[model samples]
Target: MQREPQVVEAKQQGGSKYRYRILAMLFVATTINYMDRSIIGVLGPTLIEHVFHWTKMEYAQINMVFKFAYALGMLGMGGVIDRFGTRIGYILAIGIWSVFGMLHALVQPAFGFIGFCMARAGLGFGEAGNFPAAVKTVAEWYPKKDRAFATGIFNAGSNIGAILAPLAIPLVVLPDGTNWQFAFLMTGAFSFIWVLVWIKIYKKPEEHPKVSQEELAYIQSDVEEGEIEQEKEKMSWAKVLPLKQTWAFAIGKITDAVWWFYLFWGSLFLHDQFGLDLHGLALPMIIVFLIADVGSIAGGYLPKIFLNRGASLNVARKLTLLICALFILPAMFVPYMSNQWYAVLLMAFAAGGHQAWSANLFTVASDTMPKKATASVVGIGGMIGALAGMLADFSLGSVLTASGKEGYVFAFAIAGSIYLVCLALIHLIIPKLERAKI
Candidate 1:
């Protein structure tokens, strides 16, 4: 039998802070990922109304294509990352997505709808790799106690990306909406710069010369139960998919559809319901995502507090998720608010709560599975979440086509309440959050 590597005792002064440098890279990558994906959400009303002249159903179809590709990519990319490791996997994933993201500029009005779908499909397939890679990176670099906070820190990039889109896209998209291609082209360019930086900086903790022995020991200190040997063995979808912990993670991800709704449809909902123009949409969307950034970081911190106070891993994670669920309850009232900012505040809470919930939810997979299998589990859950979002897109398209603004009531209701149901199912499935045998 192979002997486990010995962990060096960390000094009282603390070890090198190299893990944070790795985390910063993850944060930037996720920020660019979200910005590229969010360009459409920020530009949705303009593209639908002025440029593409797409019907609501046609617009939904475009989003559905992205979600479909994302779902499939989650299945494949997770396995690919596990096979190849994060450095190469991340480069391939981002390169494909970035090139395809820039391709959105080439879409013209003749067969524009189909063109948009094709572009979105490529973009979605590439974007699907972001979370799997990021989560796996966190699992590799952080101890179990610190994983949620690190995940939250990086995941907040989604909100930063969301916030930046509204502020920046408007500057690039001409007031008449004629220069929308520049919006895609400019945002897509950011990833290439990020890729260059990432190539120079990233390496595994054990392999990187810059990582101190103490930091490496600190990182390896809290190996999960059964994970020592398991980490050396290869994992597959067949090995992971049968575990109840996998379902708990996947079931919890049903809320991902709610998040996608907020990402893809939130702008359109604001436009149709409140008569907001492109400039008008920026502030509310920015505020919503800003609050979400707060939630992501704070939510990740909550579980650490619980852990420090002597809570079990299961308790800390689940309780944080429960609080997040309650925060989303107010979102059901959003569509009924007479004041626009009132609706924005309510949606902000929902967005923030989801980000917080997401931070913990991502941690759960790492908590229960071996480091080797973390990306695969995240991918499986992401695929299921994307499938749920696709269904919501199809359903909401029909609802909006028939009922117009009133359809938002149904959509908000589902978004606000689904978290509780998902949490309940998660508890039933994996009450103890036991480590997987595989």
Candidate 2:
């Protein structure tokens, strides 16, 4: 039997922080990922619905197409990344999504819903690889303990993308000469530049010239002494689906459904409830996503503090999630708040809580699974999450069609309480963050 490698006894090791450079790259890719996905959301009410004269149900149908495609994409992309490795897999994903994002600008009201649906579907498929590849990369580059913080740092890119979308999309409009299509064209083109940088810079830690010996040692510090480092065999969906750890990640990801709603609908929610136009939404949306940015980093670090105090990994991760769940509960009352700022504050809390919760939840895959299975496992979880988002989008559309802004009362309530239930379910499923026997 192979012996586990003995971990270095020294708690501290001085090293170059080259891993952070990789984290920065992941951050940029994720930022572009969201910028492309969210450009539509930021413009949904102002451009897609109002300017194009589509109904709420039509808008929901378009979002449903994206989420459904995202769900399927996650399932496929996870395995693709596992097989192809992050560098190539990530590049492929971004390349596909960027093309589709730019294609959105080419569609006109003449082509109508079918044309938009096709573009959104393609965008969702390509965007699905972002997390699976990113989480896998983190597993490859960082130790178990630092993974969450690193994930949090990079995950904040979503918010940065979200934040930038509202601001940048408007800037691209040519005043009297152009429209929303310009925003899609500009954001879609931005990713190709990042692709060039990523290709030149990214490589496995051992192979990269920029990574120093000290950093390599620190990166490998999690491996126990005498452990055999064999190449991991490819994991199949059949083999991975039965594992409780996979479900824990999946079920916990239901919260992302709420996030998807926030991403696609938050601006619309403001528009419906407060009569905010596109220009009116810029500040509030920025504030909301900016708060989430803080939550992502804070959530990532909060668990580390507990782990440092000698708590078990399970305790540290779950406890942070529980706190984040509580933070989101107040969001349920936003519909009743009457005061717009008060409602915005509650939404901020929920968004921040979700980000914080997400940072920890995403780390769970790498924490409990082998590196080879990391992307596949993340893909499995993300697929389920996207499906959940699809259901939420469908339901919200139906509800809003019937009740208008009143429908958000139901949506917010679900968003607020769903995380606590998910946390409970995650605990019931995994109980402890044990490595999969497979």
Candidate 3:
């Protein structure tokens, strides 16, 4: 006998599996975000130092510009996202960053060093919206139990972008015998294409025409109806800043500089330490980020696994963080290692540990804060993290100029120890995983 129309609709609603499709979109946007951002670091040794005859300090100053603007942008864009909603905020962000990414090609010697600084600032400003939008989207689409895994899946795109840049840039610049301009232009174009797809397809679970009732129920399964309605109300920074949960998240993020150092300086470290040119840098870069990719996905999933096994969210999350922190301890010895590959191996674990740590750290924002306030909380934390990166860039630049290879020892030591300290602070501020009162 044929099923009734109501029964068929019910079955279809229950069977619908469309959230992954949106997660895939978030993953792609993150991939493009990192690709555009990392291109400068990948090409800095060849283009900035050798081709343009820029000094290390000058290069660092340029990075300072990017970090400074990124810090401010995080603060501003966080609010923008919370106010405007993800669909509009995300498109505007990618569009702005893509234009600035392409504008790198137009920066000429005649326009002077300040011209490049301007471009970097613009890029940083636009790219700031990425995480706020992504985390908000995750918070919107997935229930709490699945959030860490979902975040980990999309967060791995950073490693993918980091991975792709080394692979793709070699093809873009080397094949033409150093048309670095082509690289910026090529990577920048990706975001433009992504924006079109996002516009056509993205909508909230409740609002999307294609989302079935069963899927919507699954999405809302973990959230209380009271919280769901309240999440739509606006939350101001004044209201959010007072919460211990906010401080715990922000304090933990202060160590974010350690990861930023790995991205911005790892290539330079290889060039200076091992006498490896750009081509030789690719394999090690690939190794570091590939492991990071594994770490990102695994780190996010581990918490879910622990939750399934009956561990408390706090215990599972913090236990994973402790393990990640221990894994990074070997990085302190990277500058002292005799063999290049040994150093490479150690840095790989450290980079991987950071990615794992980051995936969980991002989830904390959504896990504790009200959905309406998630982006704002993330913005504040990101601003703190960006400030730490700014300090690293300036200090590391000076140390490198003054001490050459020996300077990296201090950086490595700091990177190795930062997480333990930050983790301790997090535990102190928020003894439990209770959600924020907001």
Candidate 4:
């Protein structure tokens, strides 16, 4: 007695399991991507200070340079990946970043400030492609219904990298005072190995021989008829750039970079302010980042809970992000605390909240754009964000130098509260976060 449409629906429901498998490999790729990028940050305070005798302000200046290079890199990588698709573009990105990640081991003090900054800058440029490609791939693989969760899983790789480095870096050694350098080399080798695995595993949705027809229908069916009717074909940035939605994503992405830039460099901040040794809270960023991983998925999923209960994705995403942004309030107090655990707890909460906000922010890109341009738009947004980070670092670098270790209270306070303020400004421009016609 079932109608033809009913029978088709049942058939479509038959192959839901394969979707998660496709998402799993993408998640692995992202984790490795973040891991390689962060290895240098962990080693920066200990190795750089020991070898080069640089002040905290000098290190801060170098971080600012990395941010500038990374900003340009994201702008370029997005365009390249948009034209070429994720496979070839991602392979190039992974290979370049990983090579330089290991290249740090070969660097000596004689290579000095410019050489180290160049190496970090090179790493930043290559690492720039990661988000755009990963976000684009998730759009290709998962249905709209599943995309938020998929984004959370893959995006959490940055945290996973932060987590793993503490354990992995401490394992490597060299006869010289260059044990940290060897850690960079080991991580670089690890990324190169990941390149092999990524190539073996990735395929286009249509080309994936193992993908069930049922799942394919599910993915295609989720593409709204409105999206199909307006412009089914992919458009370049020239066509997409004029839209307000693109700008919204750009603002959100820039805001996102601000939050994570804080995490990536926060270790350096603590090293300067609190005198945390390699054995203390400094190296435990792995544990700190692992805890934050919970926030990434939770932030993504929490909004869906609201949506399933009838809230708009726009409403749920922004409201939840506001909550995440507010987590910085406590972090402002950590720098002033006498007890180290208080500082650690405050930093953990702030980082975890940022990860949660990150999960939802990325989902906004996929939510507001076509799958084809999700990464490209995210790249544009990332470029702006990288610049914002440089500005923040440049200002903070001066503060650190003037006040010495004690100057961090202002840094933590300002960094913590930026998200709530940024989100408010962004919403004013793109009130509904409506997807643009591209």
Best by TM-score: 1
Task: List model 1 lDDT by residue over 339-436, tens digit each.
Answer: 99999999999999999999999999999988889999999999999999999999999999998888889999999999999999999999898888
Write the residue-wise lDDT of candidate 3 on 375-421 in tens digits: 99999999899999989989998998898878899999999999999
Error of 2 at 246 (Å): 0.3
TM-score of each: 0.97, 0.95, 0.95, 0.91
Clashing pairs in 3: none
Which sequence of candidate numbers ranks them by lDDT, best first? 1, 2, 3, 4
Error of 4 at 39 (Å): 2.0
lDDT by residue (299-406, candidate 2, tens digit) is 999998999899999999999999999999998998898778888889988999999999999999988888878899899899889989989988999999998788
Count of clashes, each model: 0, 4, 0, 1
Q: Which ten residues in a row have the lowest lDDT in candidate 4?
A: 1-10
TM-score, candidate number 4:
0.91
Give the least accurate 10-residue stretch of model 1, judged by summed lDDT: 1-10
Candidate 4 clashes between residue pairs 3 or more apart in a chain or in different chains: 163-286
Global lDDT of model 2: 0.87
Better of 1 and 4 by TM-score: 1
Give me the displacement of residue 303 in model 3, in angstroms. 0.5
Q: Quote the lDDT for 357 in model 3.
A: 93
